[model samples]
Target chain A: MALVELHDIRKTYRVGDQEIAALDGITLSIDAGEFLAIIGPSGSGKSTLMHLLGCLDSPTSGSLVIDGVDVSRASSNQLAAMRNAKIGFVFQSFNLLPKFDVLRNVELPMVYAGVPAKVRRERAMAAIERVDLLHRVHNTPLQLSGGQCQRVAIARAIVNDPKIVFADEPTGNLDSHTGEAILTLFRELAESGRTIVIVTHDNGIAARLPRRIEMRDGRIRVGVEAAVSATTPLISPAHPGEEAGA
Target chain B: MNFWFGLLIGLKEISAHKFRSFLTMLGIILGVASLLAMFALTEGVARGMRENLAASGGVERVEINNKDPSEENQDLAFLSPGRTLDDAEALRKGAPLVSLVSPEMNLGNNTAISRSNITIRLATTGACPEYLEVGKYELAEGRMISQIDVDRVTRVVVIGASVAGELWPDTPDYVPLGEVIRINGVPYRIIGTLAYCESDAAKRKRAAGFSAVQDERRTRRMGKKKRVNRYDTYWQKNHAILVPISTLFNDFRTASNADGTPNWKLDRLSISVADLSLFEETLNQVRGVLERTHRGIDDFGFDTREEWFDNIESSVRATRTSGSLIAGISLLVGGIGITNIMLASITERIREIGVRRAIGARQRDIFVQIVVESGVIGFIGGILGLLAATGVIQLLIALSPAENAPVMTLSSVVVSFSFALGIGILSGLYPAWKASTLDPIEALRYG
Candidate 1:
């Protein structure tokens, strides 16, 4: 069975009598251990899709199944539990808590998961070591470079051993070399059997991933249906939604 | 998340803005301090007033005095010849619930008393032997006047501490036990000395029983050292000399008509009843007898110490209630200050709240964090307030002329501290609720 399933999902936001659809009629499924990227231009609803799939929000009308449980009608507490136990998220701004040191920032997910202190410390340190930020474990985010901050965000996402990691432009603020380094870390994490879903506006960033879905006008325009065959090109031509290659 | 982690987060936020936190807490500090100080002062006044009342025969004793002639009662006063020993004797026989009745005749102040070169103008009073127990007086040396002294009309005297110090100033350890002192050009033997100064013996007596007269000596010593005026009502007993009623009548009863008819004259009558529960009934019966003795003219009035005590108590309570109300307003202002600052703090940390919410923090967690932060602020304010109040109380005691100034009790500290903490929780409710209701998507997007 798919690890995450969205059946014709729709999300509408109301502003002053106009009902704007941030995500509409997007039916998709992500299997376990799949590495996928959702690529879109501005106002393409990729962030709203990530929000729905990651349980940060519920769809206006749709059935969402994660790990064989329907989460569309989930309570806030149940949604929080799902996020803590089954999913992890990284943001474009590298949302590391500015007050916490590197190790503490990584330990946050497990802290919410009610993990014991001793076990949380050990797992957080292991995740930090995996991201190659072991030397800066006690340093706050203000004392770290942009690349190191992104690495800390990656460590935080994986510390709870979540089934899927959702990263939205995780290297958006970094230089080219640091962005490549962060992408290499994501590649290694995906190779280790963790499902990774990244949302980005850059076609070059999307070309580096294994499977890609291009979104436009609140729907999947191209590339998700046949991309499941596990082999895709380094760069696809300018399809209907592949405006990034223009 | 666990409570310790939440508390640590709260502390970190407060420490990050130390001056703001301190300013937010200043109102609560002043409120708590003033409330506690008022409690201490009112408590002291209550204690002092009770002791003062106890010194003059306590709440159970009653005094009957001659009434002034008012516009409506002038005819009655003229018809009555005033209270006398005959009225006192009649009350003793007619009132069954009455215990002791002592008639008093006070010679006017500045009565001449001399011993060799030393002379003093003191107030003197004439009374029977029962005066010693009814008036709450204790003898420091020798003996009080006996029934024989009254029956035989003996000329013997009991001097106060002031009299002893003045007449026998040269004697290092003065004991006027058997010495003779002249009063109004007539010689009288000093039979006893009143206990006007507190000594180890006084403490022992106080511990042994409820002798309210001991309070008088203590009050005088605590006050200034200037000579107490003989006309002062409460302190006059500290500067008086007592003699037998017969001696006063034989030598000092000088008021009479031209035909040599003696006036029926007495200054005051102190009555100690057998039981305070039956005091009203007994007082009515005494009034009846006195009225009949004076030929149906009500020319006398009475007062009880219990009534005096009640009046003082209610007045003090009024002052205390008003003081507490003022302090309560300050506490309210302090609570509002906390609410305002907490709301501002939550607004500034909206993104942080969002980040934590995305990391699986429940709404309850956010609520708990904000409330705990406000509670910690109140707890800190309570401690500092108690310290400041203690310092202020000490300064007041040092500057005041009274021997004892009020100090904060442990109960007041605990009460005020707990009240302050409750204010914190109450004030934090709206702000914490506002914080907990924020949407993660919207909060994260807040600048």
Candidate 2:
């Protein structure tokens, strides 16, 4: 079964009297643990689709089901709960809180999720160790290099054991060498049965992922659903929630 | 998020921008301090007024003073004899609620009580023994005027502390109770000496060992030897010299009447009430008796301490109202300062807020964070203001006259501190709302 299903989702914004469609009738789906990439130039609605999949926002029309739960009509608080329980996001700028140490930044999602302190600490530490950043857990974001900061952001993303992890140009701010290192980390997370989606204009990153789709203007320009089914094998659902902070 | 955790974040936010937070809290601090100071001052003044009321024979005493005859009664004014010993005797006999009647003859303000070459000028009164209670006078040594003395018309006199101090600065141990003292060229024996008059504040000051040189300089400047009390009312009571009314009539009767029966008119008639609740009734009864004694002419009016107490209460209330207005404005200004800073602070933290919201923080969570931050600022400012107010109250106590020392009460502290915190929370409303309503998508994109 598909982890995320979108049926002709439409999002429109009225600029004065003119209505602009940012997402116009895009349909997509992905199985559990499949590493996917959405690639397009600026204003191609790729970011908007990523935002929708991350549950940071809702579509103006059409249905969106994530992990078997309907999300298109969820309330703001419900959207937030969905995000906390099933989705995590990594930004192009890392977006780690500047005021918090790496460990605290990683533990922030669970803090909002009302996890107990001891469990939050243990899981946050485990996430940091998985990202190979346990040594720098006490260091603030400003005290780390771009690659290190991105790793901390990833640790934060997975600390809540979300069903899906979304990265928007996650390596855009790092050098080629460091970018490859972050890609390797995401590949390892995928192999561990965590579904990963990367939004990037970098063709090289898109080619490296198991499945890739391209969008133009406000619609999908290329569909690789058939290509992905032929080349990639489906992963058995792991749920990540059981081992979370255990 | 729990409020405690939110407050922790708020504390961190404030600590990250120490200078801005302190400047923002300055208004609340000053407001609380000024509020506390105002409460203490007005409260202290009210207490002082109450003390003065009790000192001046309290609410139960009534005095009959001269009043102009009404237009209709003006024709019969001359026919009436006026407030005299006869009227005092009639009130004593007729007014059932009249506890005691003290008829007195005042020897004008310019009278000089002299002994040998030394003399001190002060107002003197001649009265029966009831003046001891009505006048609130306590005899330290020697005897008060007796009925026998009034009947014999003896020229015995009782002097106050000031008079004794001036008349015999050498005889400190003895009051010269049996010794003759001259009053306006007439020799009179000093039969009593009054105790020193001072207020509780003055007593505390003396016990605390106040600056002796300043007190000495003040007394020296006033040309008095031993004036200790800060209030002149106390000095008036201390400097008194009382003699028998019969002695005053024999020696000084404001030039005997045309028929030569010795005017017989009294200068002042003070009456004490048996029960404080029936004071007005007793006063009416006294007036009725005096009206009959004075032949139905309205040549006298009544004075009760109730009017003085009412004036004190009203004046204190006015002071509190004005003080509260000023302090409240300052507190409001403080709250505005908090609002201004919170708006700017949230504006600076928009991206941070976005990141938080993106990580599953609800709008209410963001709102609580901002409001709690504002409350933290107010709480700290209130604590600092309380500390500052303590020093301010102490300074007030030192600066104000001893009789009216400003007091810092527990209620004022609680009230001011609560206002500081309440202003803080209230000020956060607009800014928190604005921050919480920010679009998560746009906020994440904001610089």
Kindly list the per-residue Cα lDDT of model 1 for residues B1-447, writing each as its tens digit.
777777788788889899999898898899899988888787666755666566667777789877775567676666776888888788888877778888887777778999997787887888888788788778888989888998898999998766776676555348788889888888999999887633232334456673434343345447746553343334565666899987888887755547676555888888887798887887888888888888777778888887898898998899789988998889889999999999999999998888888878888888988998898888787778888888878776556423134657788788888978888878888999999899887887788
- How many steric clashes does model 1 contain? 0
Model 1: residues >4 Å from true position, as ranges? A110-137, A224-226, A229-246, B68-81, B93-96, B168-173, B196-234, B254-264, B288-296, B401-404
Off-target runs (Cα >4 Å) in candidate 2 are: A116-119, A226-246, B142-154, B170-179, B211-218, B221-231, B254-261
What are the per-candidate TM-scores when only chain A is compared? Answer: 0.91, 0.91
How well is each residue in A27-81 modelled by candidate 1, as lDDT tens digits? 6778888888999898999988998888889999988999998999998889888
When summed lDDT is taken over every stretch of 10 residues in candidate 1 chain B, the lowest stretch is B197-206
Pairs that collide in candidate 1 are none
Name the weakest run of 10 consecutive residues (lDDT summed) in model 2 chain A.
A237-246
What TM-score describes the B chain of model 2? 0.91
For residue B431, model 1's alpha carbon misses the true position, in angstroms, by 1.7
- Clashing residue pairs in candidate 2, if any? none
Candidate 2, residue A66: CA error in Å? 2.4
